[model samples]
Target: LGERVSWQTLATVLIGLLGVLVMLRPGAGLFDWAALLSLGSAFLYGLSQLMARKISDTESSTVMAFYQNGAYLTGALLVAGLFRLAGIEHAVHPSLEFLVRPWIWPALPDLLKMAACGFVASAGMILLSQAYRLAQANRVATFEYTGIIWSPLWGFLFFAEVPHSATVLGATLIIGAGLLAFRTERLRAAPPLLVPTGDTA
Candidate 1:
């Protein structure tokens, strides 16, 4: 665990965070408090990327995906069981309710829909595992910023939710940060120019 983040990398991250803050407008009284949870999730996801890279030499992507899904299923069931035992009948928040809801049998269509979600999740996990396996975690991780573009697009398509102007600005900064990271990483990885032993001119 001798990881050291350079100031340049830290600055790139801060720029990305600035973009998010611009979008969120936390000082404008419009920020959803739930985003704090997302910040925590981002930290954990970074740790997972490092762990995935560390283990990539010995494990196949499919194996990693399998275990990831298994752990998720186990953790979810444990949480649901504990919630049931605790007799928490109501969650004040919709998201919390989704998490602690009692399990029940569903119609075939509902079941199939849930199964499809599981399949997509497993495929996504496999792809993420492959990404970390094939690249430096720091460099590869920056690509996650590109995902910010999709959330707005999906909201527009599915929910008819129009993105605010700040969303556009934030998305631009986020994508720009990713591009800069890639360029920086590429430059750093390139061989240094050799000093001329003697000037031919």
Candidate 2:
């Protein structure tokens, strides 16, 4: 029980830190409130991931993804329903209907973009799970920091959003720290069950 609690707490802290970083980005109202909301999201997601890891050995990745996504979809629907019950027309209001409308039906190009995002995200998760099974969780989690390096290029190409130098520097530090910790943990562990490289040589 203590071990479980400790894992949950650590996950919460990492996620909370991520939230702080996200809220630092421009364009979210109530900087303080956004930070809080971001932290909450991070905490929940982190907890969910840790729980997923615990069960990964028992179930297939397809099963995990289905349940994980199902949970998220259910929560979203509940929220939407609550808002409707409260007589709120939408989560956020806009001056123009086009600006605020949900993209249930979009033009071809916009639909293509959404589809691409979904494909990339799903593929990334499959690869992530496979990596976790082969290596330690921390090691694969560290590689996720590479998104920081890639995000700027993606933004520049797709959205014309140039990243700040600070963002790059911060991301680099995070990636380095995560990788360093993971490598240290691996080193401390006993030798792999498989044959060593020297045996093959």
Candidate 3:
């Protein structure tokens, strides 16, 4: 906790964030209120990851995953139930409506897909917990940028979506940022050089 942060580490983080901005292709000069929601989510995520690293020493990955998944399920159900009980229906936009819509029994195929997602999510949590446990959080944290690359890759593979120039550039930057972080950390950890100031010992 008392460790000093090096400028190289800050530069790597800034580079990664720049890559994210490049990937997003934000509208020029227009502040979208919806973007704040993403900021809020990011803040919460930071807190979660911080706590994950803090307790990782004593908690098994399995235990952490169980607690996380349990809390997620409980919170989701409670929020949905409250919305349902309030009889609030907003049907203007399909996306908005989806948020407030009453819960319905999903079809068999949809249910199966949802179940599979739950399993995948739990597995992801377990893996995430292990990651924080095994390495310094800062060392592993920048790897999260890879998710941006994965999204476009998956789109191309499954949905026939073509990635644009910005996406390519963004991916390159993100990758370079990670490599820079790795290289910088290695340099810092390397043994100090010994030099002879005098001709005779």
Top candidate when judged by TM-score against the true structure: 3
Give a tens-digit lDDT track for model 1, residues 1-201. Answer: 345666667667777777877777677866466667778877877787788788988999999889878877898789788888888888866665776666788999999999999888899899999998886666565677667778898999999999999999998888888878877878878999999899686
Off by over 4 Å in 2: 1-30, 89-104, 178-201
Prediction RMSDs, each to the true structure: 2.9, 6.8, 3.0
lDDT score, candidate 1: 0.80
lDDT of 3 by residue, 65-122 (tens): 8988888789888978887788777755443467786568889999999999999888
Q: For residues 1-201, what per-residue lDDT tens digits would candidate 2 score against the true structure?
A: 113233533453364346336524555353544356656876787676667677777877767777776787799788767655676545442422333344377899998998998778777666665565555454455555556567676888999998776566666566655655555556657586785667553
Q: Can you tell me which runs of candidate 1 are displaced by over 4 Å? A: 1-8, 30-36, 191-201
Best by lDDT: 3
The local distance difference test score of each candidate is 0.80, 0.60, 0.82
Give me the displacement of residue 3 in model 1, in angstroms.
5.2
Please state the error at residue 20 of candidate 2 in Å: 7.8
Winner by lDDT between candidate 3 and candidate 2: 3
What value does the lDDT take at residue 51 in candidate 2? 70
Looking at model 3, residue 98 earns an lDDT score of 71
